[model samples]
Target: MQIQDLPYPDPGVPDVRSGSRFLWWLGRNQLGGQIRSMAWGLLHFTAVSAQPFCVGYAVQAVVDRSGTRLALAGGLMALCCVGIAVGDTFLHRAAVTNWITAAARVQQLLARKATQLGSALTRRVAAGEVVAVSTGDVEKIGWFVEAVSRFTAAALTVVLVCVGLVVYQPALGLVVAVGLPVLALAALPLLPRATRRADLQRQKAGRATELASDTVAGLRVLRGIGGEDLFLDRYRRASQDVRHAAVRSARMWSLISAIQVLLPGLLLIAVVWYGVQLAREGRISVGELVTVYSSVMVLTYPLRHFEEIAMAYSFSRPSARRAAGVLSLERSTDTEGSRPADVPSGDLYDPDTGLFAPVGRLTAVVCGDPDAAGRLAERLGGHPAEAGTTSVLLGGVPLDELPLDAARAAVLVQDKDPVLLSGTLRELLDVPASGDVEPRAALAAAQCEDVLEALVQGSLDAEDPLDARITERGRSLSGGQRQRLALARSLITDPEVLVLDEPTSAVDSHTEARIAEGVSRLRTGRTTVVFTSSPLLLDRADRVVLVHEGEVAAVGEHRELVLTEPRYRAVVTRETQDEPASATGPETPSEAAPITAAGTAGATEADDDGAFRGALEEIEETA
Candidate 1:
């Protein structure tokens, strides 16, 4: 494959059983490119190898004082130069194309697998390792793939050169035949040590990268808890470890490089000295001795390919293994079967959790364990806790059996901590069209006017909420603001079944109550399941189910459940002592005091004040 033909339509299913197999699979996919590269490489090396013979003939012609022989030698030299130029130029082009295309194909396969695995990817592989493999490891694998053809050509040239020497001068050819193998094999013993150090360096670097990524992602939280310095120190230590490992790896490679240079130098000295003795003894003439000496010098170049090939394979093997490991992970939830595109409308049920979200109703799941709640939320969206653990049935049909796109279209699950991608407010809310909920309605239901106002800060179009840009992961916004914005985005999707996990945990009690009322009003007829412990949201739900010991323990209205189930009360109230405090709670949405125009205006004014001050600060910085 060429560079222009990159990003293969289907990178093909990889043979990821082992690293070697994966590397072989890459080679097999690009067999045509490899052949082209190898052919060019052979031409280039062969042309280069012929230069020594031309020089030898030219010297002999000059010694004989023959004008005709000199002219012919000059002609042969010119031809060799042209061949070298064409071969070298095209060889480089073909080799680079193979390298880039191979890397692109691996990256495509990795990205596709990552999308398929979803959240389960982190569980199967370290986030840091995945990053390393997709970036550094991919380059190393491509390097090996591209080097293979060149290495083959070099080895072939060395063999042919040795054979030519043996035919032209038997004594010198024997010396070269014996010396070249020794030179190539001499570094074999040191390779194991070098490879071990390289693996160690790779491991250390991956850990450091992972730590840096995690530290950056959690920087806001770390600063909030006054743990930024602690994490910084940890990262510093990790960086130091990586540096040490790299130095050790470099030392081993340096030793190998010395061996490569030292052995070739000794072999050159031996060949020239032996050829001089042969000429002195009349075993070979002056022209033949010069040719033998030049041939040995030329052989030195191709001989280095042996060391290069070894190093490339050693490094790429581990990289390919890591890449294969990531590719090997299957989506924990089944993605098989060719089912129909449409799913019937019915309640969503997970047999594993024994929880059912009734159709066209707002159901609240109150689980004491947040982990259990998150797992149940994932299951509701057809992502089981484990592969084939159990089935979540939608309309009495297994969710896993449904086509993946159809299943996803039928349900939307919002995680407890959702990420807002870097983009304008409009782009952030841009999701697949579903029901009637518009961006405005969704933002209102999510109680996110403050968020939009906050995003408008320090902007040229200060009044245009949709045009205001959000930083990566909405890091520029407060925790509450980010949470509300995520809720708004989710609400905008307006899926038939919307599963929310702790959707309003970051918001205040008053705003949470308003959001609960707004969500209930907006999702009047759609099936919505919320996994939360807040009393405000629980009281707003049409029905409440308490999950305990991994299964549905009790099902009833919020008030009856709080009154009857102590576990439910403790979980919803956040403590045993707070259970009685819920007794005098508001009875209905109206009693909870709906979001008033004046209240929203006040919130907007407060947000705008913050935005205005931020704008002034930005202006000062620009000035």
Candidate 2:
């Protein structure tokens, strides 16, 4: 594909069997571009090679004192100059096109793979590695792809020039032809060391990049915990390691370059010395001596392409391997036999936990362990801990059996710390939806009016809140603001089944209550499963399931479970008291009378609110 038609509709499935294989696959896919570049390269090098011949003929003509031959030689020299100009221009254009298109294709493939894997991509590969592969690595790979064609043309030109010299003047021709191979092979011994050094530098650089990424992502937390210095020191050491590795790599490559220059200079000296001896003996004319020396000089130019191609391959091999590693990652739901499964009309069931959210109902799941709750939420959305082991069934069909798109469309899961991508507010909310809920409505439901106002206030041009630009990862916004915006985006999708884990954890109690009611109102008929222990959200749920030790312990209304199930109360309210509570029998007046007593229930709720606020404060501090 052309660079202008970039972002290929399909980047084509890459053959990620190995790094070298991946590079080969990329080359094969862009064969047409390679051929075009090679054709132009051939023309350019051939034209350059002809210049030496033209100069040799001109010198001979001048020595012969023949006016007619001199005029013909001058004309050929001018024509060679024109050919050089035209060939060089088009050759550069074609080479650049190949480089840009190759890089673009690789970028598209990485993006597609990232989109396909979603959160799991980071889990399988380091965030820094992904960044490195998509950025610097892409350029390196393109460099190698473009270098191959030029190297081919240069090699061919050298061979052709040597053969021409052999036919024209065998005495000097044999000297150049034999010396050229020696010069080319002189750097071969150093290449292995150079390649190893480069690979080591790449590894160190990747680690340093990952460290820097982690440090920046948690900079605020590091500052809060007074650990900034510790991380900074760690990063400094990593940077030093990378620097040392880079220096070593550079040293080896520099030595190879020295060898290339030294050997070629020696070859030129030998050719000139031998041609001068022949000239003195009257075995070769002054014109032939000049021609041999000039040809050897010109041949040195193409000889450097040999070292260049080797260096390019050394740097790009590791990059290709890293890119291949990322593309090779598969999501838990990815399977060769996966097929489209219709949206289920029945409950979303987690067979592993015996937990199910009935169709068209808001179900609240309460688990003592937040980690367990998060895993359950992911499983409900068809992303189990392991591939081929998930038993989450929708309408009696395994969720993992469905195609990724179908499963994602059928169930939308928003994790506790959902990320808000950088973009205009309008663009952030512009997602695949059923057209049932408007962006404004979703924002209002998620209590994001204050967030929009903040965006407007922070904007330099006082643009509309929807038009304001968000920094990467919504880092410019507060935690609660980011959380609310993420919720709004998820709400706009209006998927068949929406699973949220602590959707309002970052917000205060009042905002949480409003969000709970708003979410309930907006998702009236759709099925939504909320995993939370917040009383505000649990009270709003039509059904609450209490999960203890990874299994459903109780299923009842929030208040009913709070009074009847001690385990549920302990888990939700963080209550330490182990007082026995009636399970099968109705509540006695002593237990139920407090609810009817004036201001008594309010006092109890105030206590619960205080406890909840304390818990939130602790979570925020820990974060």
The lDDT of each candidate is 0.83, 0.84
Candidate 1 C-alpha lDDT tens digits along 1-623:
67787679899999999999999999998899888888998888888888888888888888889889889989988998998899899989988888899999999999888766666677678888898999999999999999998898898898898899899889988998888888888989988888888899899999999999899888888988999999999999999999999999888888888988998789888988888888888888777778888887877777777888899998999999999988888765556545777865689888977899899999999998898788788778876456546878888888887766778778889999888899888888888867588999999999988887777774677578998999988888888899999988888888879999999988887788789989999899999999998777877899999999988999998767765676785686443422121326557654442222112212233343353345334323332
Residues 300-403 of candidate 2 have per-residue lDDT tens digits of 88888999999999999999998998998876556432665566657888877889889989999999999888878878887735544456888787877887
What residue pairs clash in candidate 2, if any at all? none
User: In candidate 2, where is summed lDDT lowest over 10 consecutive residues?
Assistant: 593-602
Give stretches of model 2 more than 4 Å off.
332-342, 384-388, 575-623
Cα deviation in Å at residue 396, candidate 2?
Answer: 3.1
Candidate of highest TM-score: 2
Cα error of candidate 1 at position 169, Å: 2.8
Candidate 1: Cα lDDT at 112:
88
TM-score of each model, paired residue for residue = 0.87, 0.90
Candidate 1, residue 388: lDDT: 48
Tell me how far the alpha carbon of residue 573 in candidate 1 is from the true structure, in angstroms, after superposition. 1.2
